[model samples]
Target: MPRRTRVLLVLFSIVTVLCAWAGLMGLGRLTNSGFLPDDAPVRDDNRRLSAHYRAGGADLVLLVRADTDVDSAAVAAQGRAVGERVARSPGVVTAVSYWSAHDPALRSRDHRAALITVDLVENEGRATRAAQDLVPGLTGRQGPVTVSATGPAWASVEGMQQSRRDLLAGELIAVPLSTLVLLFVFRSLLAALIPLLTALVSVTGTLACLYALTFVMEVSVYAANVACALGFGLAVDYGLFVVTRFREERAAGAGPDEAVTRSTRTAGRTVAVSAGIVALSLCCLFTVPLGFIRSVAVAGVLVALLSAAATVCLVPALLSAAGALLDRWDVFARLRRARATGSAGAEEGAGWRRIGRAVCRRPVLWALAATAVLLAMLLPFGHAAFAPSDARVLPAAGEAHRTQEQLRRDFAIVPDRTVTIGLPRGTDRAALDTYARAVAALPGAAEVRTADGVYRGSTHHPAPAGTAPVAAAAPAGPVLTATAASGRESAEARRFVREIRGLPAPGGSALVSGEPVRVVDTTAVLSRALPPACLLAAAVTMLVLGSFTRSVLIPLKAVAMAVLSLGACVGGMVLIFQDGHLRGLLGGFTVTGTLDGAVALFVLVVAYALSVDYELFLLSRIREEYLTTGDNTAAVIKGVQRTGRLVTAAALLVVSAMVALAASGVTLLKVIGVGLAIGVVVDATLVRGILVPALMAWAGRWNWWLPGRLRRRAATGDRHALSTDEGAEHAH
Candidate 1:
């Protein structure tokens, strides 16, 4: 390319990136829907039922804490005033207070703090905006009552906001750490920084892609976090591979153009295959219905492919343009020149070669040891608990988190756990009474509220004097809320949900909605979807890798390694976060005793992708060396020796991002960070460094085995590959 054209291309690229950055900034409007699918029955029912009742619990709640008993006349009067003020707010459709309704469920067990449940207008977008505008004012002093506001809308909005803040904080740390590692590995300031150029483009480009996607689909806020973090990490990865290869080729006496050509031919193929496999793995997430999971999948696949393209297209351009000036700083040369002078026999890759030989010497023993270790890591997963995230995952200072904490500590029946059952249309008075009584009679029911009244055990209390009814003309029919205090994700609460779901509908049908019901339904959805997603991910990964490497066994082995890596990582998470291990080391967050299934699946795809990423780095060299020499053991050793440092540099960059996540206050983010970092480190060091080389050595030529018919086709198809590789030696 001419100098003027190169300069023009660079300027155009910079302009494009700046626009993407601005587009990403405008994504401040991004929001995450409460961890429910768009098509969940609860959404439709709640929209209709919200018109008449605080259906599926309050969209907003004002907690009134007074100096004296909440039932005292003075406090009761103030609480009623607070409720009326909230009710008079423009968007509030209804506001029911403990004082107004005299409902036991609305009052705290200690009678110090009581709730005023507020339902907003039905349109979600307008309701959310209304809650955001109204909630801040409703909090703070209200005469004698000190009010704090929270509810489903408040928590969702707060969590989304906090997550974006943390994502910024996380990248602030991750980028520097990754750069430091790259600096050390490359040993030149420009060399270290050049790879990050690809990262800049990859991240901005992905956000631009997502911004466009938001026009057609509701993208989760978490998707941008995934795209930016993982994009930078993977972009650096491809850059490291290609830049290192170019340097090696140049060092071995190739001209600049010749070196770029060979490096792109060899290392570029690995980057393309790596991206394809990772993209294929992410594609499996479409099996899940949740927008949260599928959103991450879309962002992940986009970043992976874009990262690969950015690195391949730009790194070589920069390297060739810089020419001999690329190594000007030459920190490694300055430091090691004396050693090279003292010992002429010293050479690159000696350490990695020695390690490979050691592992290959006892292949079965090493493989078994690694297997046993990974299995031991997985033991805790058998007893692992799963749940959707609640307000507790937000920062401690957040109003929703504080409100939830107070509810858990002071209330006997958390209104948040109240499951609303939407009764079928045309329910007569008799059936409504019968269904309410039956639900109230269930073993774990805390209290049941029908349109007519409240029921506790065998007792019934008529509705407060002026409360609106579920109109007979309403298409949603009737709505009832059953408060259960067994804990939203607890076995007991879920059991209550299941039992009520099994109950015969009073008129004909019912739809359950609330915290516990959401937990149950989400868990069930993931349980059904995850297995198929994993199967598809693994099967498709094998097909992609197999076609890329022309090796049946290597792809299968790659899948096994990735699965093992993911299992061990999640098992480690179950042990630490779920089982409450090392509280001090993790910055003293609460152990929620369960993993977020959605976050787990997100981490699963990421860890699996990284595992295969390292595997491809290793396999590419081995495949190249093996074809050149037709000697399996030699190829295994040489491949490990050649690409070992490149893999380590890439692995450390990815791990740094995860480590930043581990430091977050959000327990689920911490789980992802610690778990994925540990998993990637183990895979890069132990699995890639040991088991892969050992197994390949033991398998010999079978490591590259393909059916005879396919082998012939691959040979015929790879003529250009052979021509490019004609003069390649086993080692630089």
Candidate 2:
């Protein structure tokens, strides 16, 4: 081994060990935070409401299922007791129940259940701790009623727990399965192990980086799962490229050191470009202004960069150490020997070569057919709908989801969806009353309540004596709460909030705030940010690909291909999750008629980057072959033959990890997992195998064309110099 390589190996080893330790130490302390952006308007409104009304909404809720009538004295007494116990619990700010409010809406329509709403102090960590402490004591049986606890605070804690379990389960399934796939591909145990080790190190290092980030800013619970899956996929991808190239070099008669050097020069360059593409694509998430999206981006970028670093610095050193031993301990030694002897020039992908030749034989026909199929797949995305995350995102069997469903089914009012319009403080009773009446008159508005009374569709009803609070004591402002006729996720509810916001304020300054408004605002933010994000991703991808390939048309074609694959993936998500197709086969989630907006955006960005990832792998090899042999057709055929199997193997490994994520009980994670898996499969099979080869064949020598100055330089032999330097830099 070279002295420089040995030194790098030692440096990387120390860093890897430190990262592993930091990951372990930080894993347990990672908190589930950053669900909402700090600067969101809805957050400010929620804060104002909490301060003024002493109601932080329902942080915890106890569902009291009565054996007999819910309104009966026994059931009422039990409900009150449960409410009082929760109110007295540490960190609880207030509690309300059917007994305290005497509100009929708290009682189930079947007269078999009632609800107790508890508002905890507005500290996430403290509130979660208090809620956990109170759960055991408050849940189960309370006199004649069976008590079950759930609400935002409890759900937050449970969501974090569930996410951790899902990550563990996904890794358990993905790691073993990925190992088997790698072993099958390489037919050597040592070769198989190297990629997994790199993945572990990269993922652990990313976790450590995320943990450090948590101290400075909130990180989402979902980031861990995303980081693990992406880290594993990217690490294995880079490793596979490097190792496969090394073996090919070795098979072509290079010594171990020379093989390593050549493989690093070629495959290492592709890995660097691929990593940069992924990092730049994820950086688009920063434009969305939501913590959850930003956290995923942060974790993704960390994993991609770290994986590339390991691939370039660590994997080569390991390969140098392994030398000729990489081919030993093969589980499929006979097949490996057959492969080595049967194929000349290390072009072992005869099957892929045949496919590429077949496509090139009728390039126009193949390209048209593939493009038509992709467009047909994209048809469903035209009807795609989106909703913000909510309790429905959890499993149906979960307590939080059950409570949410029960509330929706039994109660006339949806508290979470109820929009609160805050008028100026000291607003007169008549002005508040007029505002309430106007809000009630809006379409889809069920009822509007103010300190004066309740109003329905322009009709005012005075509150019972002493029920209406005197306006003189109003501190934060006079509030009119409007309950939507439809559920929060419904278009009617969203429209209602929008219409209400468009209405003239009685006090000349009113803030409309609630779950529906939050959803609307979040959607709006994402919608506004998406165009710029896409532009940035495209610009960065074009720049990176142009730099790597030095061809304008190739980068443009690559970007278009990425968009096509992403469109198909989005269409598939809409068809399966939103349109409710294949629900029975893919874990029967309640087809909520809409995809989570955040999840959809996340899938688009990540999947596009990954699609581009494979493109770079194939195109870089093709470009290299063309530069060397000066024949575009032979270059395309040989490039596909050389890299096709490796690309498919990497895709299989990534898709396997993604498919494992489908086992998660959370609907959002399931959608993301399934959607991403589908994307990889499509990109690997149809896009990479068929479309790319056909398109390159049809483009011919034009695929390698450069502008005037670059063309002159290439003709003068600067191209080789540039490519060599890029390969060396990326290799180390």
lDDT per model, in order?
0.80, 0.82
Q: Look at candidate 2 and give me any clashing residue pairs.
A: none
Look at candidate 1 and tell me the lDDT of residue 598.
88
RMSD list, candidates in order:
3.0, 3.3
lDDT score for candidate 2 against the true structure: 0.82
Per-candidate clashes come to 0, 0
In candidate 2, stretches whose alpha carbon ends up further than 4 angstroms from where it belongs are 1-17, 69-74, 88-94, 120-137, 335-347, 464-474, 714-719, 722-732
The runs of at least 3 residues in candidate 1 whose Cα sits more than 4 Å from the true structure, single-residue gaps closed, are 51-54, 71-78, 88-93, 121-127, 331-334, 337-344, 425-430, 451-478, 718-720, 727-732
TM-score of 2: 0.93
Candidate 2, 1-732: lDDT as tens digits: 678878987887788789878876776666655555556677776666667755446667778898898768888787777777777878877677877766555678887987787767665555776787888787777779998877767777777778888888889988998999999998999999889888988998899998898788777778888898888888988898899989988876777887888788778978988999999999988988777889889999999999998888788889998887897899999887797788756746888999989988999999999999999999999988887777777778888788788887777775676776777777787777777787899888998876656788978876666443211123666666788988777889889988988888865777666777877887777778889999999999999998878788998998899999998999999999898888888777877788888889998999999999998888887877787788998899888887789889989999877876787877878888888888898899889998988999999988878889988866667466656755754664
The local lDDT score (0 to 100) that residue 426 gets in candidate 2 is 70
> What's each prediction's TM-score?
0.93, 0.93
